[model samples]
Target chain A: MSNNNALAARVRGTVHVIGAGLLGASVGLGLRERGVDVTLEDQSPTTVALAADYGAGRLRTAQDPEPALVVVATPPDVTADVIERALTTYPNAVVTDVASVKLAPYLELLRRGLDLKNYVGSHPMAGRERGGAIMARADLFVARPWVICRDHETPAEALALVEDVALDLGATPLEMTPEEHDRSVGLVSHLPQVVSSLLAARLIPASEQAVGLAGAGLRDTTRIASSDPELWVQILGANRAPVVELLDAFGKDLASFADALRDPEQTGAKRRIADLLSSGNRGVARIPGKHGSSERFTSIMVLIDDTPGQLGRLLTELGELGINMEDLRLEHSPGAQIGFAEIAVLPEVAERAVTDLVERGWRTL
Target chain B: MSNNNALAARVRGTVHVIGAGLLGASVGLGLRERGVDVTLEDQSPTTVALAADYGAGRLRTAQDPEPALVVVATPPDVTADVIERALTTYPNAVVTDVASVKLAPYLELLRRGLDLKNYVGSHPMAGRERGGAIMARADLFVARPWVICRDHETPAEALALVEDVALDLGATPLEMTPEEHDRSVGLVSHLPQVVSSLLAARLIPASEQAVGLAGAGLRDTTRIASSDPELWVQILGANRAPVVELLDAFGKDLASFADALRDPEQTGAKRRIADLLSSGNRGVARIPGKHGSSERFTSIMVLIDDTPGQLGRLLTELGELGINMEDLRLEHSPGAQIGFAEIAVLPEVAERAVTDLVERGWRTL
Candidate 1:
C-alpha cells in the first residue's frame, strides 16, 4: 500500500476487518482508499472473496503480520463472540466492533471475565436499507456520526487509535458511554422503527379502497416499515430495555391522544389534541438541520420532466442564476411523467430565485 | 364568460362559490379558466377580494342571474350551515359542497328535515400543507380524486352537475356513499395523521442527544405532524366515529408489537414481531401507485454537490442517455456539503442506467 495518508501512519501494522458485510467492507474500502493496509475475513469464504474483489480489502493470509488494529463488523447476534475472538487472537492489537447496540455486547464481554482494556465498542451511525459487501461504499461514513464507547480504565492511546480510524474513514467521532449510546439509539432509531412498523401493520387489514386513498403523508410515515424484519428482530432483542421503555411511553401517549379525540366534547379535549400536535411541531423543529443546527431554509419547487438531463439543466441554470442551493429534493409520483425538484436556499433569495427561474421559462411551484 | 367547455354548458348559468379559501378559490380559478361563469363569496370581504383579484371569480351582485350551481366551500364547522343556507337561497339551483368530511354535513341537513333532492356532498382530495387563496392553483385538482356522495332523493341532474364541475376541474370523479367516503378516509388519512402526531409528540420530552441521532426514517415518519392542528381537529371531530375506531385499533396494534418485543424469549414472540413488521411491507405495497396501480421501481442514488447546475446537468445527461426516470428523491444531511439524488427507473434498465451514469462521471450508489 502507498503510504500517503498521515492519519493512517498512526497504525504501524495492518488493520484486519472481520465479517466483510456492508459495514465491515465499507470500513475496509474506506481505509484502503487512504493507503492503509487492510485484511478482510468472513465466516463465508464467498462473502470475503466478494469483498476482496470489490476492492474492500485483500483476504487475510498466513503471511500477514499481527494487525495493529482489529475491527469486528459482524451481525448483532454474533458480535460479542467475534469481539471476544478478535481480542483473544490479537493480544497486541487494540480491538473495536461496529455494532449498532453498544451495552449488550459490552456486558456480555464483561460477563465472560475477559480483560477488555484494549477493546473499544464503536458504532458508525450509517447504513442503507439493504446490507452486504456488494452494497459497501467507501464514502458511506463521510460526515456521519461515529460513536466510540470507552471505559475509564481504557488507555488514551487505545481510544485515539479507534477514533483515528473513524476520522480516516471521514466519520465524525463522538465519545459516548455504552449506556448513553443504547438509550439514544433506542429513542432515535429503535422506537421509531417499532412505531412505524405498527402503523404500517394496521394497513394489512385495510380494504383496498382505503389503501387507494393513501397519499404522500402515509407513504412518508410508513416508508421505513419496509426494512428487513429479521435484522430488526435481532437489533430490537439486543437493545430491548430502552426500546421497551420507549414503546411503553409512546403507547401511553397514543392511547391518550385517541381518548381525547374519541370524546372531543369533553372539556379540554380539543386543547389537548392541539397541544400534542403543537408539541410535535416543536419537537421536529429541534432536529438538527441537514447542516446540523436549527437554521431554516426556504424551498422552491420546480417542475421537470422525467427525461434525462432535465433536472441537471434546471440545477445548472440555478447555478448560472447565482442561486446557492442549500438542499435539493426530487419528488415524482409512482407513474407520473412530471417530477418536482424542491430546492432549498437561503430565505432571502427565495422570492428572487422563483422569479428568476420563472423568467427563464422554468415552472416554479 | 365565453362558452368553451361542454361540461360547463351543463350548468347554463353562473356557479357560485360560498367561500374564498384554498379549495374555493381553486375551484373558482379552474372553472373561470375553462370559460365557466363563476361568482365568489366569503364572510371575509378581504379574502373574497383577494381570490377575485387572483382571477378566481368576480363577487356576486344582486342584479346577477340566479346561479345554476352553488358550491359550499366553507370550513367543516360551517359547511352544514352554509349548505342549508345555499339550499334555501337558491331553491332552483343544485347545491354541492367541497368539505373534507361528507357524512357529518349530510346528517346535519337531514336531521333538520330539509328537502335534500338538490344537495350533493362532494370532496376534492387535493390540498397543499398550507391553506388560503395564495396557495390556490387552477390545476390543483388535476389528476386527483374527487368524491361525490348522493342520496336516494338526489336528482340525476344534481349529481351530474357536481360530477361535471369535478370533471371540468380535471379531477377523476369517484362515486361513493357518505359512509364509505368517511370510512375510507378514516383509514388512509385520519388514522395516519393522528398516529404520526402522537409519535412525534413523544419526541418533545426526548433528550437533545436522542433527537440529534435521528435519521431519515424519523423525519419521514413525523413529517406530517407539522400539519395545522386546528384544521385536523375539525376534520377529526366531524368524522369522529371512523377515526376513533381506527385509532383504537391502531393503538392495540402498537401495544401488541411492544409486548412481543419485550418478551422475545417466549414462544412465537419473535415470530409475532416479524409477522407484524412483514405485514407492514405487504400493506404499504398495497397502496395504489401514482398512476393508480401497485407497481415497483428500482432506485439509483447519485451524489451531487450543493453547488449550482450539477443536478440539472446529471438529469440532462440521463435524458440524453434515453433513461426514463420513474421517480426521484433528493436526500441530504444537515451540515453536509453534498446531497444525493435518488432516481427511480424500471428494474430492467436500472443496471444499464447506473453503468451509463458512471461512465458519464456520475457517482451511482
Candidate 2:
C-alpha cells in the first residue's frame, strides 16, 4: 500500500476490522483510501471475501504484524463478545466497537472484569436503508456525528487513536459517557424508529383509497419504518430501559392528545390540543436548520419537461439569477412528462427569485 | 375577459369563491387561468382585495349575476356556516366546499333541514406549509387526488359540476361517501399529523446533544410537525371520531412494542417486536410511489464544492450519461463549503451509473 495518504502518516500499523458487514467494510474501504493497510475478518467467509474483493482490505493472516487498532463492527447482540474476543486476539492494540448502543456492551465487558483500559466504544450516527458489504461506501460517515464514549480511566493515546479514525473518515466525534449516549440515542433514534414503524403499520389495514390519499406528510412521517426489523430488535433489546421509558412517555402523550381531540367541547380540551401541537412547532425548531428546512426556508416549485438536463439547467439558471438555494428537491411522477423541482431558498429572496425566473421564460409555480 | 380559456368554453356563468384563504385563492387562480370568470369574497376586506390584487379573482359586486357555482373555502370550523350562507345567497347556484373534513359540514347542513340538492363536498388534498393568499399557487392541485362526496340525493349535475372544477384544475377526482372520505383521510392524513406532532413535541425537553445527533430519519419524521397549531386543532376537532380512534390504536401499538422490548426473554416477545416492524415495511409499501420514493429508488450521494454551477454541472453530466433520475435532493450545511446532491435512480442502473461517474472524475459517495 502507498504511504502517501494522510492516515498512513498517523497510523503506525495495520487497522484490523472485524465483522466485514456494512460498517466494518466501510471502515476498511475508507482507511484503505487514506493509504492505511487494513485486514478484514468476519464469521461469514463469503462476506469477508466479498469485502476484500471490493478492495476494502486484504485477508488477515498470522504473518501480518499485530494491528495498532481493531474495530468491532458486529451487530449489537454480539458486540460485547466480539469486542472481548478482539481485545484478546489483538493484545497490543486499542480496541473500539461501532455498535449503536454503547452502554450494554460496555456493561457486559465490565461485568467480566477484563482489563478494559485499551477498549473504547463509539457509534457513527450513519447508516443506509440496507446493510451488507456491497451496500458499504467509503464516505458513509461523511459529515455525520460519531459519538465516542470516554471515561476518566481511558488512556489519552487510545482516545486519540479512535477520534483520529473518525476524523479521517470525515466524521465529527463528540464525547459522551455510555449512559448519556444510550439515553440520547433512545430519544432521538430508537423512539422515532418505533413511532414511525407504528404509524406506517397503521396503513397495512387501510383501504386502497385511503392509502392513495397519502401525501408528502404521511411519507415523511413514515420513511424510516422500512428499516430492518431484526437489526432493530437487537438494538431495542440492548437499549431497553431508556427506549421503554421513552415509548411509555410517548404513549401518555398520544393518549392525552387523543383525549383532548375526542371531546373538544370540554372547556380546556381545545387549548390542550393547540398547546401540544404548538410544542411541536417549538420542538422542531430546536432541530438544526438543515434538518428543519421546511420551517426555515421557502419553497418555490418550478415545472420542467421530462428531458434530461432540464433540472440541471434550471438550477444553473437559479445560480445565474443569484438565488442562493437553501435546499433543492426534485420529484417525478412515473407516467407524467412533467416534474416538479421544488427549490427552497431564504424567504427573503423568494418573491424576487420567482419574478426573475418568470421573466427569464421559466415557469415558477 | 377572453372567452377562449378552457373553463369558459364549458361553464355557463361566473364561479363565486367565498373565503379568500390559501385554498380559496388557489381555486380562483387556477380557474382564472382556465378563463373562468371568478369573483372573490371574504369576511375580511383586506383579504378579498388582496386576492383580487394578486389576480386570483375580481371582487364580487352587488350588480353581478348569481354565480353558476359557489365554492366555500373557509376554515373547517366555519365551513358549514359558509356553505349554508352560500346556498341561501346563491339559490340558483350549485354550492360546494373545499374543507378537508367532509362529514362534519355535510352532517351539520343536513341537521338544519335545508334543501341540500345543490351542495357538494370536496377536498382537493393539496396545501402548502404556510397558508394565506400569498402562498396560493395555480398549479397546487395538479396531479393530486381530490375527494368528492356524493350521495343518492346529490344530483348528477351537482356532482358533475364539482368534478369539472377538480378536472379543470388538473386534479384527479375520486368519488366517496362523506363517511368514507372522513375515515380515509383520518387514517392517511389526520392520524399521521397528530403522531408527527406529538413525536416532535417530545424533543422540547431533550438536551442539545440529543437534538444535535438528529439525522435524516428524525428530520423526515418530524418535518410536518411544524404546521400551524391553530389550523390543525380545528381540523382534528372536526374529524374527531376517526382521528381519536386511530390515535388510541397507535397508542396501544406503542405500548405493546415497549412491552415486547421490556421483556424480550419472555416467549415470542422478540417475535412480537419484529412482527410490528415488519408490518411497518408492508404498510409503507401501500403508499403510492410518488409519496414513497425511499422504497422504490436507490440514492447515490455526490459531493460538490460550494462554487456556483458545480452542482449544475454534475447533474448536466448525468443527463449525458443517459441515466434517468427518479428523484433528487440537495442538502447543504450552513457554514460548510461543501454540499451533497443525493440523486435517486433506478436500482438496476446504480452500479453502472456510479462507475461511469467515477470514470468521469466526479467524487460520489
Cα lDDT listed for each candidate = 0.84, 0.86
Q: Which ten residues in a row have the lowest lDDT in candidate 1 chain B?
A: B1-10
Candidate 1 local Cα displacement, residue A147, angstroms: 1.2
Listed in order, each prediction's TM-score against the native is 0.97, 0.95
Given the true complex, what DockQ would model 1 score?
0.68
Each prediction's RMSD to truth: 1.9, 2.7
Candidate 1 achieves a global lDDT of 0.84
DockQ of 2: 0.61
lDDT (tens digit, per residue) of candidate 2 on B108-167:
999998899999899988745357888787877877788999889989988998898998
**Model 2 TM-score (B-chain only):** 0.94
Indicate which candidate wins on DockQ. 1
Candidate 2's C-alpha runs over 4 A off are A1-9, A291-295, A331-339, A347-352, B1-6, B291-295, B331-339
Candidate 2 residue lDDT tens string, A1-365: 33335568678999999999989999999998988899999999999999999889999998999999999998888999999998888788999999999999999999998889999899998745347898788887777788999989999999999999998888889999999999999988899899999999999988888888887788789989989998888898999999999999999989998888887778898899999999999888877665323247888888877787888777788878778777776654423466678887889999999999899888776
- Give the chain A TM-score for each candidate: 0.95, 0.93
Model 1 CA lDDT for position A350: 99
